[model samples]
Target: MKNIIITGTSRGIGYELAWQFADAGHNVLAISRKTPQTLLGNKNITCLSVDLSDETEMEKVDNFLSHSWKTVDIIIHNAGSLLLKPFSETSQEDFENIYKVNVFGVANLTRACLPYLQKGSHVVTISSMGGIQGSLKFAGLAAYSSSKGAVITLSELLAEEYKEKGVSFNVLALGAVQTEMLQEAFPGYEAPITAKEMADYIFDFALTGNKYYNGKVLQVSSTNP
Candidate 1:
């Protein structure tokens, strides 16, 4: 079984992804700000409480991985932050906070995990459809969208830089999946896909995507919007 690392596992898509991977017999290093409520006692899962945006907390994660595992097969960057407000009203602090978790956190964690990632390993970072230009732009999500955009670009550059190492990097630009974050972003709107559904797709991709894809930003959406 492969040893996998997934961030933002406390809730939503990240939590579901952790469960699916563990159930499939993979050793999952689940990281989040808090332990997932449903994953309290699973043997295949190890939970690390970490604020990915904080360097100190991420250092602990790096240390754990360094000592615990000889190799990592998949690294899924699912942890993210969102802030919704009109661009004119969005503060510098608000923008930075979003970037800290969504962009910088991914970079920091990936760097920390690089040593353990061997040949044929896959790195998947979750972006958003909102980040794509001309794709259902929402007025209040300027900061969130911009950060996700940065994630896509970063993943592309890493993919190019790491191709010779047999490491594959890709970004999944997801549409609105029903989750707390989506509810917060658009209170009355309903998403077409559920978190578990998205998790299934992601888990499958993470397992076999290196064979057919890399250096790509794929959009996962069920609706035109």
Candidate 2:
């Protein structure tokens, strides 16, 4: 069984992904700020209540890997911080806070796991369609969209840096999904996709997409919104 690490497992797509990976007979490390009770008794899963933006908290992942895992097969950077506010009303702190989780946290966490990532390992980052340049843009997402875009670029760079080593890095720019984060960004609007549905796609991609592509961003959207 492959050893996989997933972030943002407290709810939405990450929550569903944790259980799905475990059910598939993989060893899963589920990390989020709040641990989910659903993962409590699973033998295939290890749940960690962690703050991604905190450097100290992320070190625990390294510790766990050193103690129990042979090597990491996959890492899904699913933890995200969303801030929806009009540009004029958004404060500097609000913007920085979003970057802390969406950008800095991604960099720090990836760096921490690199020692355990060998050839054939995949690093999949979950981005948003809003982050894509020239894609549809929405108001009230200045901080959120910008941060997502940064991560997309980050993944591409990592893929380039690790090409010789055969590690793969890719980004999935997802469209509107009916998630709590979506509700915060746009209330009263139903999305074409559900959290579990999106998780299903990610699960498959995390497992095998690296064989076909690496250092690329796949736009996983069927709708404009």
Candidate 3:
């Protein structure tokens, strides 16, 4: 079974992803701010509670791989921060906070995990449909969507840099999925998909998509929400 690393695993899609991978017999390292209550006893799943924005905390990831596994087959950058405020009222600190978790965190964690990633490894950075150019845009998500957009570009650049090394990098620009983050942002709005459904798609993609794609952004959405 493949050893997989998934970030943002305390809730929503990240939580589902960890369970799905473990249930399918793949080794999973689930990282989040707080460990998932149900995943505590699973042998196939290891939970790490960490602040991804901190370089010091990221060292624990290196330690885990060095002590437990030989290589990481898949790395999914799923952690994100959302700020829904009018552009006029958005502060620079707000932008920094959002970018810290959404963009910089992804970069930092990927860098730390680089040594364990082999030729066939796949790095998937989760993005948003709102981050896609020419897609529908929302006013209050200037910071959130901009950070997501930045990661897509980051993945593309990494893909080109690693092409000869045989590592693949891709971005999934997801549309609205019925996640806790979405419910908190828009209480009554119904999303076209559920977290588990999207997790299934991502689980399969992370396993085999690298064979056919590298540096590609797949926009997974049904509507503009």
Instruction: List where candidate 2 sits over 4 angstroms from the true fold.
Output: none
- Winner by lDDT between candidate 3 and candidate 1: 3
Candidate 1 lDDT, 1-225, residue by residue in tens: 999999989889999999999999999999998886679789999998988888777788777887887789999999989887889999999998999999999999899888888889999999999988778988888999989999899999999999999999998999989998889877988889999999999999999988899999889999786
In model 2, residue pairs whose N, Cα or C atoms come closer than 3 Å (at least 3 residues apart or on different chains), thus clashing, are none
Alpha-carbon lDDT, every model:
0.91, 0.94, 0.94
The alpha-carbon lDDT assigned to residue 103 of candidate 2 equals 93
Candidate 1: which stretches are off by over 4 Å? none
Identify the superior model by TM-score, candidate 1 or candidate 3.
3
Clash number for each model: 0, 0, 0
lDDT by residue for model 2 (115-159), tens: 999999999999999899999898889999999999999999999
| Model 1 global lDDT (CA atoms, 0 to 1) | 0.91
Ranking by TM-score: 3, 2, 1
TM-score of each model, in listed order = 0.97, 0.98, 0.98
Q: Across residues 119-198, which tens digit of lDDT does each residue of candidate 3 receive? A: 99999999999899988898899999999999999999999998898999999999999999999888899998999999
